[model samples]
Target chain A: MIRGIKLGLLVVCLAMAWGFPAQPAGANSDMPKPAARWVTADHSKFEALKQDFKSGPEVTKACLSCHNEAAGQVMKTIHWTWLSPDAPPEAKLGKGGLVVNNFCIAMPSNEPRCTSCHAGYGWKDKNFDFAKQENVDCLVCHEQTGTYKKFPAGAGNPASEPKKMGPETFLPPEWNKVAQSVARPSRDNCGTCHFYGGGGDMVKHGDLDSSMKNPDRNLDVHMDAKGANFACTRCHTTIAHKISGRAYKTPAAATRISLLKDDQISRITCESCHSETPHKVDVKLNDHTDKVACQTCHIPEFARKLPTKMRWDWATAGQRDAEGKPIKKKGPLGPPSYDGMKGDFTWQKDVRPVYQWFNGSITNVMAYTKIDPSQPVTLAKIDGDPGDANSRIYPFKLHTGRQPYDKSNNTMVVPKLFGPPGSGAYWSDYDWNKAISAGMAYVDLPYSGQYDFVETRYFFQTSHMVAPKDKAVSCQECHTVDSRLKGISGVYMPGRDYNRPLNYLGWGIAAAALLGVGLHGLGRAVARRKNGNHDHQA
Target chain B: MNGNGNGNKPLYLYTRFERFWHWAQAVLIIVLAVTGLEIHGSYTWLGFKRAVEVHNFCAWTWLVLYAFVLFWMATTGEWRQYIPTTKRLIDVALYYMVGIFQGKPHPVPKSERDKHNPLQRMTYLSISLILIPAQMATGFLYYFYNSWALWGWGAKLTLSTVAFIHTAGMFGFLAFLVVHVYMTTTGHTLTCHLKAMCTGWEEVGVPPKS
Candidate 1:
């Protein structure tokens, strides 16, 4: 029994071991690997062939033999500056002198990766030293993999010079002397990087993932077919041997330049081949064109996101009560006072005061102006004792020479009006009630105007605010429209003015009517069948 | 099981105009709901632009039908049936809330004089008199925004408020549709009400008055 149990236990252990297995030994093992090397037509063989052709200058005899003046133009382009000895030290470091790319991982700046796009030799740091400057180096543009001279054309030895002419450069004895020139960078080559996963911070306007999946990825910016027949440099002419925006000066100018202007030609934009006018605005066909920007109203964001609500606030406008006190407390009283004066009262700074008023019930009436101290003041009203024989009138006129109300001073002036006798009524030209009414009306006009503009602009300004006249809108504009005033009760919209009960009642009635008619018809049908059967029996 | 289905005399009073309006309104409502949902991006069976066109067409059709229905109901004295009743209304409410769910029969009986259940009368009355009209008004306000501006009323009225009202109405309609669908399923065999809607004939049976 012990022996049998041991065998069964061993079998179970094997099953569990196989099911929940350990990682393979090869997975974690590490070993030194051979360095990678490129094998192709030997550079020595090509050099030897060139030595026998000591018939003319190297550039003239070897490169211009086919490229002609085209080779000379390429030398002046920004692409060539990648290897220029005079290029800024930071430019050689790639993006902003931070990240280094793997393609040009070594061999200074003149490696295969750098020379692949640059068209020169021995470019390291700021040193662009080239011996054979005019060698068209056909493999760079045509891709290193496929070449006619290296293939069907005499089956050139694979061990020979790896730089073989492409089909475009392959010339017959008669066509050998013909010259071809390419002035611009190819969109396809630019798209290779400008597309979804294109390296670097270029084209950072949202992810281009969906655009890359588009079948026309290989096409030019205009959505036209890019044949393998043309070279990238044909249209992307060299401007001081550098990419476009590297030459920008100001930060603002740099942003505009590097971000690709809407109508300008760039490797990533459709304006490269198509007309700069992206949209044909037939005003008759689309009446909305007068108010809409193509990018502003029709871009991807508009179709996806739209504002659904309007926001407004009115309580922040320094509301006051009938007692000439600021309404600031929660209830129908002004904010609590601590120093024999009202709470911290603040009125709108922009308001121009045209009138003022005071009470005439007390003999020692004092009024203080908060804004100005230098201006001479007049007593508009004063308190008086009733039935006193020596009573005096409350209203008092200011000296003729006193300065008019001066708004420049930031101090308050208190005007004291006192009399030992009784007085009944007091009056002055400064009417606070009338001034407040007028100011309220004026303020409401702009408020209502802004509200109306927001309503109308809602349809078009999906992501914008209705700015208050000249200033941008603030949160308080929409949130605090009806808040507590200083101390008195203020009437907003009163008495069921905006109530929606009628809406509910209307819906209820209509639905009831539909149900009634439907059921009544059914009832009649049943009743008619019963009545007809009874009549037939009779 | 006797010769006739009910004891009342046949009214034969439902005019051809009323029936036409009723059927057309029902069809247009279904079309509108389906097309409106498509516009909301719920489904893409009908492309967005095409769905919008259909929705607009149905909206106009419903508006025209509503006018005719209103005129017919007003002049023919048919609108009287929708007037509210206080007697036995609580019984009708209880029948829907608890009795119906318990498989107990409805308290209200179908007859030539009193066709609608009390709950049906109240709900339909609210929808027809309140919600539908408000939705129509708000919809028109939105559609004629330019005209409103030209008339100078646009300065006072906000389109966002109108949109809020319209969206609120849409929710009301959706709620009504949910109840209607559930009630339809509650009929005998689960499809009895659906068949009646399609053929204008419903099977009648005695309902217990509890």
Candidate 2:
């Protein structure tokens, strides 16, 4: 019997060993060996000859040997005329030629960095030959060859006999046709340059990284997974060579800018793919049509700049001591002072000051001004009151305040005068009636004297008094206005913060119970063991 | 070990109402968890939206049942069973920590009047009265945030803060689930306690001497 048991055990052990492998003791299993290196044929002699051959002349000869007629067509491309002797008069950067980028070290028009994206040869010199069809920089589209690694190795010999170019001289016809079909300029391609992560100057409206990772990020019609897969060119085909005049200025303009228009200037729109109904119920555009765009209200955080430094203290505003005297002295309506000291000053240059003001309980004023006294003053203000009828009008002011002072002594400063209190200088106020009467224009604060044409920038800071903690979206908001389909009736709507404590308590109870049961079971096991030991001794 | 010994009026420990509530809650919670996980795409035990709908329904039922149980306990004076006490608590603790492993007797006896061991009372009291109620409150707060806003609450509260509270509750639930599963395996014969929950009868053991 003992021998049989031993044999059976041996068989089981052998089976286990075969099923699961154990590496040899002390053996290292994970090191990777180096790959073999390759040696290349020597071409040192060709390198010397390369210096003597004029690359431009050689490239021209090569082009003429194959693409005689197509070379003329390629010359008409903007790539051929990239560099010009004279700068365009209409460029925004003024006569020095338009600098498309400012992040790079400022370069003149002749620099290679700028000209690389432009089309032309020997662009650094003013003698750029616009008529040269041979130097039309063909590698932009025909980028298969001339890649950094493949160059020189792939550069055909200058003296080699040229082969006749056929239809193959262009890209594969199928791929070329497909590329044309999907060729509208898309934000994706543009996004390579325009998106926030790409180091471009475009607006970073939504955080792309977080939005992409967010499981619940909203996907509108324009951003539908299927719709986004299509190339941008499938829609935006207008002004193909130059994108300058093709951008949409308004929501209405976007609808009109399609590829199907009689003017052949049409472009695709989001409405093409998405369901037309934006909301659960279609909202009709009445008088508010011009005032709002689908993107204006729905586009998350469109107008939200980072919260300006919070300065207005609502709790302290209009606060008084027991004696009824103002607890804190009020300063002038411009930049806030760090030390609470107010001083009279004059502008030394032309200045345009922007201001933000609240028409509600708290009024905050901020201004930027030129340091010179002789400059004209222009003012802009963003104004609104939460409870007023005309609460959202922002206005611009282009006049100087009339507060006079002794320029020589800089003393006996007359009380600072603002534009007439009801004039179009103040942006917002609590009186809704007055705001409407003023044609929703900004009015100047009241002041009594005349000053120079000094421009001061001001911003009115308003307090968002509504706290987020106390608000919740109720079921009724979705269900009441419509049918029962909107209501989630049987759902266990646990309070927002309740699950954690409940879960914690559940775990605590379970742990305590486990401890109790485990101890009891162990006790029983020990008792059995003791009994067995007693039996064995007997 | 005769039939006569078994006839000793099968000492009733848990009240009928208490047992009913316990079993009901257990069933509801299990259903909630299974369906909840399904809704989250953690598994495909059930279809997606269907699982979500079922989970929500069960959760509501559980909440309602808990409320009724709370009312019954309060009215019938049965809540006294969960009142925590220090008596024999240290002995119970030592039994769990050292004595039980040495084959020593249980410090607290299972009795007709005071059914819970000292540790049991504390655990049940905290879970039933404190944690569950807190979870419910927070969950409700999240569900009705917009309504709260309409009632001038949004003017004060942020949605992000509410979302944080909800997420914290989910973590707590997960922690509880882990401990619950581990404890279920530690009964006499391993499956003894589980069988008792199913049949509503625990095979009483002999009282240990002090």
DockQ of each: 0.05, 0.06
Worst 10 residues of 1 chain A by lDDT: A451-460
> Cα deviation of A75 in candidate 2 (Å)?
42
TM-score of each: 0.35, 0.34
Summarize candidate 1's per-residue lDDT along B45-158 as a digit string, tens digits.
Answer: 565446656877888888888888788778867676787777789987785554544444457655445656677788778988998799788877766654665788955887
Model 2 agreement with the true structure over B72-149: per-residue lDDT tens digits: 988978788889999999998887676545544456645556667788798778778776776676556654554664
How many Å off is the CA of A268 in candidate 2?
19
lDDT of 2 by residue, A56-170 (tens): 3343444355447645665543334432222332322211222211112112322332343333345543345656666554323332222111111112111122222323121
Query: How high is the CA lDDT of each candidate model?
Result: 0.36, 0.37
What is candidate 2's local distance difference test score? 0.37
lDDT of 1 by residue, A1-538 (tens): 9999999999999998888756432222242111122243433334322443321123234445444565556555434443222345543322212111111112221122223233432332333343354443332232222221211122111112333432334322111211111112333434333331211111111222123222131211212222112223333333333343222111101111222344343432112332233335422213222222222222212111111111111112224568644454432222121111122211111111111111122111011123223332222222223223222111121111111111333221111111111211001112322322222232221111111000000011111111111232211211122211111111111111122554455446547755754564454445446555321111
Predicted structure 1, TM vs. truth: 0.35
| True lDDT of residue A151, candidate 2 | 14
